[model samples]
Target: MRAKIYGGCVSRDILNFDEAELIKLVSYNARSSLATLGSNNAAKNISKKHYDSLLNIESKFQRRMVESDFNNQILESAGKGDYDLLLIDFLVDRFHLAEIEGKLVTRSVEFLRSGIKPDRVVNTFSDQYLKLWKEGVDNLFNTVNNTVGLEAIRINKVYWTSVATNPQDSMMLNEKWDIEKNNAKLDAMYEYVENILPSSSIIEVDKNLLVADSDHKWGLSPFHFTDDYYRRMVKIFNA
Candidate 1:
């Protein structure tokens, strides 16, 4: 999935930017880092010589992850502007907060190489994470092209998911769900998001949408979603 998003921006032809004929979307995982910085020490994946160049892109891309960007050539402005929607996932940010705060938590690859149990990492970064959450989220929004008028939404957790595993990959970089701490920051995130964006710009997820039950279909990880959910999410965009 990460690679797919990167592929969208790696070159220039991913999407046409006609506001009338094209509906553009810019999405990124804000957890690891932004622009060029790797949030959960994921920066190591990038070379120091080229890392800075990777970010602050004229193309408008990502951090631990990469994203689609709107360049005059890659995309001509849709007339009103370029993109029609902007989506952010709250999961990676939570995962990122844990990595930043946990005294022992580190990127899964780093932890694996050191032979440390992911769950054994101590939970101590909550305070520090909360302090930076609002500032980070706000700064991010401010960075967008105002003509875009971004629509932001938070994804509710897929129930019965394990705390210590990466849903997309089986990497173990976390141990506890830390729901108390995670949700506290999430609430604060929504509060600030509401204040900065119009009520319609933010989508409030249904509380019972992904609960664990006989219909349970999200065991793969917290970030994974059902096809129906994906279809419904696209409906939220104004494209």
Candidate 2:
């Protein structure tokens, strides 16, 4: 497949680190103030300034990875013409899922689920889950386009229907309504797709379909999902 790149504020290769050592350092420093943590060299006698710098660098790296991954995934999906069904990871405050509308342009629909804040849309998923969704969208877009020549679908917005209080709630909802929400989201998504997809296509999915879910935890900001949730969403989009 052709590779595409995304643009973001963070630099590339920011996450290169010794996972074990980094984890150890973080665990040890969890209680320490930045200044004290800096002086303690449990992982290595790295100065406080250097240690803090490394943490900041790692964070930036992660952010860049998310941006690049998301950009590439969307482009690949577009190229393959899989615009019918799109699954997004968590939506966080820093990463605005709405921004996707610019690229999709009413071609597709989005289904969103969150584990913390239900009032606003957001959720968390593993990086692997995010990758799978990206792949699924890519395949769906490609298959539909190849079978019948037409414009590819574009995802509108992810649906946020239900909320979860904790992991247990999340699991229960996923088991109970995952498929149902998928169908609902698909229905809502089709509305957008119908308006945007070419009129000549023999195979078509509905455009107005979407499913939305949420969690119990309140978001730090009313407009954004938590950082962890946002990261998960980025991974999904990118994957």
Candidate achieving the largest TM-score: 1
Global Cα RMSD, each model:
10.5, 18.4
Top-scoring candidate (lDDT): 1
113-165, model 2: which lDDT tens digit per residue? Answer: 11111123212122432333344344434544564333422232333334343
lDDT of 1 by residue, 1-239 (tens): 11101111111122222233334444322223222122233212322333343354333423233221111111112113434444444444444321222222223222233232233332224555544555445444544444444442222222222232224232331243444555665566567667876766555445444322222243443334334344344444433
Q: Model 1, which residues run further than 4 Å from truth?
A: 1-81, 96-125, 145-147, 150-176, 212-219
What clash pairs does model 1 have?
19-78, 32-39, 33-39, 101-125
Q: What's the true lDDT of residue 192 in model 1?
A: 63
Residue 231 C-alpha lDDT in model 2: 37
